[model samples]
Target: MFFTDSRLHFFRPLVGKYREVVVECVRLLYQKLYTDLTGYGQSHGRDFVIDVFVEAIARAPLLDEEVGAPEGRFKDARALAGFILNNLLDNGWMERRLDEATLQSHYGFTRMGRGFAQPFVESGKLEYRSRNRNTRNTRNSLQAFAEKGEVYDLLDALEYSERIISDFADTIAELEERRLQLVREVESRQLIEQAADQFFDFIDTVFKPDLEVRLSADSVEKYRDQIASLIRQVRRRRKYGEGEHAELLWQTVMEMRLRKLLPGRVVEGQSLLENIVHTIEERLQSACDIMLPALRRALNSFTARADIIIRQLSYLHRQADEPLLDACSRLREMSPDNQEQALQRMGQVLAGVRSGWPASEQFVLRSRNRRRTVRATLANAPGLDRDAQKAQFISQVLDQAFHVSSQHIRAYVSDKLITQGRVYSKHLAVQDARQLLALAHVVSLAGERLDNGFEILIHPARSDSAGLQVFEASNCGDGYFDSRENFELELVDRQRAS
Candidate 1:
C-alpha cells in the first residue's frame, strides 16, 4: 500500500505538464501489481518491470542439475514477470542505475495485454494519427474556445507545428528533385544508354540480313545517319536535363528497347527500322499542316513524342530482316495483285526521303496515301509473315524458358491431355495450329493471376504417351493480350489465316 501511495504521489506533480500522461502511467503500474502476471518484461503490454532481472538469473547455473530448464529460458513471459517481481520485492531496485531511453520505453501491464500499454486518450488531447486528413479537427476547434476567452496554447502549438512541418516537407521535395538531376548526369544516363546499346546489339546479332547490306551505300548511310542521330539525342536528354514530360517520353523509348521492340537479333533488324521510320515519315508528311491526326499524338513534340517513335523504330530495326524475309515466304498466300500492291506501297514509304528531308508536294497528299505504305505492308506482307514469325517467336521464348531448342523439332507438341506434370500439344511436328494451341497452354499454367509478367510453364506428358512433352504457356491476366510478348511461331498461323 505504501509503494502504491508513493507512486501515485510521484505522478501527481507530472499533471502540471499533462493530465493524460499521468493518468495513463498510473493506470498501467497498478495493473502490473495485480493479475495477468507474465515473466516477459512489459510484454503483452501487461506485467511488472521486474522481468528485466530474468537475464542475470538465466545466466547463473543451478546448484542442482536436475532442473530441466527449457531453451530460451528468459524468453518465457511467466519467468520474466517472476524475476522482475522478485527483484522489486527482494532487491533494492530504486537505487539501480537508469537512463531516459529505458524509462521512456518501459511498460507495465495495462488493461490491454498485447505488448502495448494503453495510455489514456483524453477527451481534448492532441491525437497524432492519420485516419483521415484532420481538416476539421484542426485549430478550427479553437474557434469555440476563442470566443470563450480560454488560453490558446494548444491552438497556437497546432497551427505553428503544422506550418513548420509542411514547409519542411516541401523543402525536402525540392532537394530530392535536385538530387535526381545530379543522378541523371552522373549515373542514370549511362545505365539507359547501356540498355539501349544492348538492345540494338542484340538485334544486329540475330537478324542482320544480306538485303540491308545490298541496299545502295547512299541508302545505308541515310538510314544510319537517322538512327545514329536519334540515339544521340536520346542519350543527351538522359544525360542532361529535359522537361519532366520530355524525359518521360524518352523513358518510354528506353522501355521499348528493354522490351525487345528494338531487339538484339540481326536478321530482322534493318527492315524493322526502315518500316517504322518510313511509316512515321509518311504519316507526318501526309498530315502536313493539318495535324496529321494519326501521327499527331505520336510525333507532337521532338523530345518526348519523337523519341518514343524512334525507340519503337529501333525495336523494329532489331527484328527487321526476319520479318521481311518471312514476308517473302508468305507472299504465296496472297493474291498476285495484293502481293504486288504491298511491295509497291512499301517502295513508296521507302521512297521520297533521299537524305534527311522527305520529298515535296506529293509526299503526304492525303489520309489514304499518308498511312498507305504502312497499311499495305502490314495488311498484306506482315499478315503472311506473322504466321511463320509467330512460330519462331514461340521457339525463342521456349528456348529461353526451358533452355532447349526448336530448330529440328518444328512440330513439337502432341495432342495429349496433360496430367499434373503435363506435356502439351504444340510439340508435334505438324503445322502452326498445333503450335499456337500448345503455346497458349504453356503460357497459361504459370499461376499468373497475381503477377503481371510473362510466365513459362512446362506441362509433363499426358497419361502414358512416350514422346517428349514440353508446352509453353504465358498467362495473360485480366484478359489483355501482349502483341510484342507473342511467340514468333503464332505469326505463321496468322499468315495462313490471312
Candidate 2:
C-alpha cells in the first residue's frame, strides 16, 4: 500500500544525478521546519523554503560526473532550488496552503514527507537519548493497568515492550559499528592519540549513559518478575469484565486497526487485547532470555577489541620512541648472513668493554667437583599374616572409635544435661570403657567454655579424704579406671555466663 502511493515517485530525485544535493536539501528543510527551535514562526513561506533550499545546494559538493548539463531554467543555484521545490510540491513531499488568520500562503511538509525526511535528518548523528528507560516504562504501564484497570495503559505497555527489544538490538548494532570503525582506524595506522580519543569519546557519549544503565538498574531481567505478575493481574482482571469495558476495548482495537496503528492480522478467535498481552509477554521473555545476553556479548567484544587496539597502538608508539627497538626491527628484517655479520661486528666492538660497576668480591678460580651418582634400591618389606593384619586393624578402629574429641565430649555432656539440666562427674554413667574415658575427659574439661551454648563449672569436693570421695569407673571386661571425685560439673548457658 505504501509503495503504491504516487508521492513515492519523489524518490526519483534521490536516485538521479542530483541525489547528494537532494538529500542535503531535504535534511536542511526538515531541520528548519521541525528541529530548529530558534524561531517562533509556526509556518514557512515559499521564499523562506527557497532560501533554505538554496543554502543546501550551495553547501553540497556535486561532482563533475554527477552535474551534467541541465535545462536553461535550472542553470543557477536559485533556479535549481526553485526547480527542486516545484518537484517536491508536485509529488506531495510538501504542500502550499493558505492560512485564514494570516491570509498568506504558507509552505509546510505533508505527513508522509515529514515521516520520510526524519531519517535524512538523523543520519550520521550519534543518538545520545537513553534507550534503557523502555523496560522500566513498560513495567510502570503494566502496573498502572493492574491498579487503575485502564485498557489504554495495557496498549501503552505493549508498545513499550516492542520498543525494549528494538532498543537493545540497536544498541548492539551501534557497538558493533563503533568497534569496526576502531578496527579500521587501527588498520589505517591512526595510532595512540587518535584511537584513545575515539575510545573515550564512545565511552563518554554512549556507554556510561546508556549501556551501563541497561545492563544494571534498568535491566529487563531486573523487572521481569514484577512485569510478569502485573501482566497476569491485568489478564485476570480483564476476564471478569462483562459489558461496557469489554465492548469499549473491542471498539478501540477496531478503531486502531482502521487507523493502521495495530500491525499484523489478529488470530481468528483471539481479541486484540489478548493478542497484545501475548505479544508483550513474548517480547519480554525474548528480551530477558535472548537479547540481554546478546547485548552483554556485544559489549564484551567491543571492550576486548578496544583493549587490543590500545595495546597495539601502545606497542607501535613504543617502537617509534625507542631507537633500539627500531634498530632491532631493522636487524630482524635483514638477511641471515647480513644479520650474522652485524652481530659479529657488534660483538667485536663490545668484546673488551664492561658496562656496569666492578664486583665487590675478587674473582677466584676453583677446581670443579663432579657429583657422585647413586642408584635407588627397592625396599623389600615383610608381609604380615592375616591374623596379625586383622589384629592391627581392630586396634586402629578401637582407637578412632573411642577418640576423646570435642564433638564426643559435647555429645556426652549434652545427652546428660538435656534431662538433668546439670551433670556431675561422679554421677556420669560409666557403662563401658568409652564412658570411663569420657568421664575422665569431662572432669578435665570442667571450668571451660563449650560452644554448644553451655559452659562447665567446677565445684571443689567437700571432703579431703581420698577414700570417701574416690569415684570408681568399671566396664564389663573392657576396662576400668578410678579417680578421686574432687569436683562437681555444672552446666551454665553462655548467655547467663556472659
Candidate 3:
C-alpha cells in the first residue's frame, strides 16, 4: 500500500502534463480534419482559402453575392455561405459570436481551428504556393551552411560553421591536456574521477554532435576553399552576370548591406575581399593544427584504468576466510604417510581405467513408431554426370575448329574463338570452359584423328614448331582450376591413306 501510494504521488504531475498534451492534440486533429464543409474538397484551391482566411474577404464575386431566388435546385450565394458556416460550426472548426455594442452576429475560427492553422502561417508554408514547403525549408537551412551567406550576412555565416569546427578542435585539445596531466604526475583520485565524467560528457554533447555534421579538420579545409572561391567571385563582381551562382553571391552582398557592412551596393572592394579570405584561412589553419591522437588511446584505456582502480579500492573491504586458513594449516601438519596415501588416491582418480562394454549386434527400443517415408525425387535431385557434360563440351570445341585445316591452337583455345554451340559463353562458365580446353588439349596430344577429317595435335605454345602454344585461362572467381598455364591445341591435316 505504501509503495503504491508513493508511485501514485510521484507520477501525479506527469499525468497532469500528459492530459494537457492529449487535449491539445485532439483539438489539432479536429481542425485539420479537412471536412467537405470547408467547401474545399481535395481539389479546392489552397491560395484562395488562405487569402479568404487571412484577409477576411472572398476573392470570387459569386461568394460575396446576396441571397436571391433559387435558380432550379441551386440556392443563392448568401444562403450557400450560411450553410457552409453552419457546417463548420457543427464540426467545431468555427464559432459564431454576438457583439454586445452593435448587437450583430459575426463568425471566426474556434480554438481548434486557430491552433491547427497557426503552424502553416508561422512556417511560411501558407505564403508559398507549393505543398513541398517543408522540404524547401530543410534545403534552405543546409544551403545556408554550404554556399556563402544564405541564413545571415556573408562574413557571419562563414564564421558560424567555422566556429563549430573551432569548438570541436578545442574540445579535443582539452581532452589531450587532461590525458597528459594524468600521465606525467600522480593526480588526486577526485581529480581523475572528475576528468572521467568530463570525458563522457564531451563524447555525448560535443564529440557526437560535431561528427553528425562532419565538423572535422578536413571539412574545415573544404569550407575554407568554398569561402575563398566566394570572395574571388565578390571581388570580380563586374565580369559575371546574374547567373545562378552569381545571383546567390549577390544575395550574400545584399545581406551584407542589410547588416550595414557594405555601402551603396556593388561589392567592389577587392582589398576587403582579400582580408575576408585571409581571415577564413587563419581559422582553418588553427583548427587543423590541433593533434589529438591521445583521444583514441585515452578512450580505450579509460575503462581498464577504472577497473584497476576499483579493484584496488575494494581491496580494503575484502575479508579473510577462516576455513581457507584452517585448510592451509592442516596441509602443513599432514604426515608423509597420509600425503602419500592422498597422492595415490588422486593419481588413481586422474589416471582413470578404460571401462569396456560388451559389443552388441543391434539396439532395440522399447517403443518405436513405424516411419512411413514417402520417397520421391525432389527438384534438387543430383544433376547429370559431369564427365559426359565435359566430354560433350570438348567435342563441340573441336567440331568448330574442324573447318579450319591445321588450325592455330590458340584460336580454338580462347572463349572468343569458339563460335559453334557457344559452349564457352551460353552453356559453360569460365571453369567449365577451362576444363573443355584442357580436355581437348589432352585428346590432341594422343594424336587422334576424328571423323571430322582432322588430326588433333598438342605442342608447346612457342614460336618454333617444337614448342606448344600456351593458352592461359581467365581468372576464375570460384577458383576451381589453375588459372595461369598454357597448352596449345592444333588441328592438323590427316594424310590420305590409299
Candidate 4:
C-alpha cells in the first residue's frame, strides 16, 4: 500500500506491480472506449469505464461541481491513474483488471468502434483493406491496436480535466447571469399585465364568435359550451388583489367591459359577447400577419446555412474522415424533422455508392458479404467514373496527400479481388502493429489523396532493410475510411515456394 506525497509528485513507496497494472488498465479501458464509441449498438462505452473508475474507489454520488474538485484529476496523465494511486493509499489489489478472465469479460477487447451510421454503419463491414479479410490478420489487428488510442487522448483529457472544467465553468456562469436577467424581465412583465389588463394574456380572452345560430338542442349545446369556455377564461384570470400585476390586469379588464357596455345599452337585443369576439379576432389576425414571415425567414436561413456543413460532413464521413460535430453549432432552430431529413439524406447518398465498383466487372450476388461488387441490371448504365480521385491528386498537396508510395498508386481494388489462388499469411510482431497504429494517424490526415483503396506491402526488400511499400489506389473508382488511425492493412507475408 502507498500514500501520495503531493509535494514529491509520486506515489510513496508503492507496492510491486501495482503501478504497472494500474497504467495497463487505464490504457486498455481508454482504447476500448473509443473503439466502442465508433462501434454501433455497443454495450461498453467510455462512460462505463469511467463509472467503474469512480465506483471502484468510493467517490459515491459523483457531483458536477466546479472548483475544489479533485486536483489530482488535473495533474495525472491518465484519467484512472490518480484514482488508482488513491486506491493504493486506501486498499490493496482487491479486484479489477488483475486477471485474464475478468479482462475478457463483457465490455471486453472484442468491441470495435463502429454506428458511425453514415457510410460505415450502413454497410456493416470493415474497410476494404487487403489483410483484414484473412481471419488471422483480422484477429491479430484487433488484438494489437485495441488499446493504443486511449494512450493518446483519454489520458490527456483526464490529466487536464480540471482545466477543461474551469474553462467550461466560466461559460456556464455567463449563461446563469443571463438567465437571472430573463427571470426578472418575466416578473416585471407579469406585474405590468396585472395592472394593465390581465396577468395571463392567453387565459384572459373570454369571448369568441357564436355565429351559425340555431334553435335545436345540438346547436344550443354548442353555444352553451362556448359560453362555458369564455366564462372559464374570465374566471381563471380574475384573481382577487393578488399583486401589482393582478391590479394592472384588473384595470384592463374593467376598461374592456366599459367599451362593450356603451352607456347602459344593457337592454339591447344584440349580446355584449358578439362585440368582444370581433375585437379578439382583429388582434389575433394582426399578430399573425406581422410575425409569420419573420419566423419563416429565421427558420429557413438557419437551416440553409447548417445544411451545407451537415451535407459536407456527411459526405466526408463516407470517406471515413473524422466528422466535425461542432459544425452543428451553426444550426439554429433545429427541429426533429430537420434532423431526420439530414440523417436520411446521408443514408440515401451512401446507398447510391455501389461497393467494389471499378474492381468488379459486373455487380452480382443476392446478398453480398465481402466489401466487393454490386452489379445492377440496367440496360443504360453510367460509365465507371472516379473524377474525384483525379481532383484529389490535382494540386501539389500536403505530405500525407503526396505520400501514396507507388502499390498504393496501383492495385486499388477491393481485397476480395486478390488473385484466385493466392494465400495471405503474416507473422506480424506486436511492436509492428503499434508502429502501424501510430502511422494510421499520419496516413488518414485531411489532405491525403489516397485513391480510396491501396495496399501496404511489408517485406524484407534487402538482407537488413525490411520495410513497407504502399501501392496507391489507381483502380479504385471511389471509397472512404482512409482516416482510420487505429487500423491498417499490410501484406504481412508472401512466398510461393512449396
Scored by TM-score, the top model is: 2
Candidate 3: misplaced stretches above 4 Å? Answer: 1-152, 173-270, 291-498
Rate residue 2 of model 1 by lDDT: 31
Candidate 3: pairs in clash: 409-489, 459-468, 460-467, 460-468, 460-469, 461-468, 461-469, 461-470
Ranking by TM-score: 2, 3, 1, 4
In model 4, how large is the Cα lDDT of residue 214? Answer: 14
Error of 3 at 212 (Å): 7.0
TM-score of 1: 0.17
Candidate 3 Cα lDDT to native: 0.45
Instruction: Sort the predicted structures by lDDT, highest score first.
Output: 2, 3, 1, 4
User: Model 4, 99-194: lDDT tens per residue?
Assistant: 365454233331111211122232333233221111122222222322221122222222232232232343234334433443454345333223
The candidate that achieves the highest lDDT relative to the unseen native structure: 2
User: Regarding TM-score, does 2 or 3 come out ahead?
Assistant: 2
TM-score of 3: 0.25
Please, what are the lDDT tens digits per residue for candidate 3 over residues 349-447? 768767767567565657887999897966786766999889999999888754332243344344432343122221223345544554444434347
CA lDDT, every prediction?
0.37, 0.76, 0.45, 0.35
lDDT of 4 at 261: 46
